[model samples]
Target: MQIVILNDAAAVAAYGANIFATQLQKKPTSVLGLATGSTPVALYQELIAKNKAGEISFSQATTFNLDEYLGLTGDHPQSYRHFMNEQLFSHIDINKDNTFVPPGDALNPITACKEYEDKIVAAGGVDVQLLGIGRNGHIGFNEPSSGLRSRTRVKTLTKATVDDNARFFAADEYQPQLSITMGIGTILEAKKVVLLATGENKADAVRAMIEGPLMAACPASALQLHQDAVIVIDKAAASKLADLEFYQHIEAENQKLQAHLATL
Candidate 1:
């Protein structure tokens, strides 16, 4: 449950990109868990910059996206598949064959969910997972009340998630009521996890995830139990944290250690 308070959203994104680059350096074919939403847009941009600089190459990497709207086709403007293409896939060198997004339009969504999890297992599991929290603390589309051990499955979206995601669609009516998402159990299997939050809208959720009880009410709180999870937030999003200075000191120490390792 490490927290990093960045000076701004760009700093958060830069740090996240560095983390991704570090993983790719260690394992050229690393399996990456990706997420959609405004919170990760800047991070994707930073990744693109790294790719352009030849600092990192995603050509051999495999990607598994967290979720997709159940009824939406891949071409739908509001679909997570489309969102990933526009935000990331198009700009990166990764092969299309190595990327997987849950089949949103599958006639049998339950089967599709099971197969999605199976695909991840066959790919050797995710090395690192990127997450964005919903306003209600949902991860992927696993809303509140989702069991900790739940597998990939179809989930009904809460009205708040619909509203928060409505901006991507032409109208609220276009938002899908159901989504297929990786379960918290699946996410916890990743070797490392990075969750990002920016803006004041996320402040309360960030505080609850870090300081509040690990109740199902806030699904992101489950990260508290993960051994290598990092929550990188901008100042605005970290506003509700009580021990802000303590977190900063810890990040500074981590930076010093990283620098020492690099010199060695």
Candidate 2:
């Protein structure tokens, strides 16, 4: 796991955006694993601008989202599919047909989960998977105690998660208490993973993810076992990490090494 501490959320988004921009430039047909939520909003905006400027293009890209509310249809206002269309697909040149979000309205969720897994394998797997951590250190909807080697499936949302997401729904709106999400093992399969977090509210979770043990108790900590996982956060979000200075120093040295290699 690599930790990158930025000055603020905007910087974190810009840094994460650069990673995506570079990936798209290197492989225009890259299969990307995307995430939803406020954290990724800024990053998506950055990508939108880059696409507009012709710095990157999603014309040939295929995307898979992390999860979707179990009972919501694609056209539902609160569904992840709708969120993706509004935030990204509509703004880019990417073919909407190539984008995949777990089928929230599937009659047999069990079969649908298997099909979702199969689709990912057929797409050559994800080149880069983007993520956003919850305040409780959950990734996707795999709340606490999720199996470390689980796959795409339906999962019950924890009370904390439901409460956190309550704000998105109207007072009388029906909020889904379940979701279909990519499992920890499924996420670890991606060639590279980039997780972004910001704000002091995420500080403790960020610390547990980067500095905690590799246990299912903190699902985000599962990233510690991934071969290539990058954790990008603002200083505020990184406040609780024990080795903040060390992480910063390591990034600095890495930058210097890359610079030297560029000259060589």
Model 2: per-residue Cα lDDT over 127-184, one tens digit each: 9999999999899999999999999999999999999999999999999999999999
Error of 2 at 222 (Å): 0.6
Cα lDDT of candidate 2 equals 0.96
Candidate 1 Cα deviation (angstroms), residue 184: 0.5
TM-score of each candidate? 0.97, 0.99
* Whole-model Cα lDDT of every candidate shown, in order: 0.91, 0.96
Q: How far does residue 6 in candidate 2 sit from its true spot (Å)?
A: 0.3
Task: Pull out the clashing pairs in model 2.
Answer: none
lDDT of 1 by residue, 29-57 (tens): 99999999898999999999888899899
Model 2: which ten-residue window has the lowest total lDDT?
A: 208-217
lDDT measured at residue 66 in model 1 versus the true structure, 0 to 100: 97
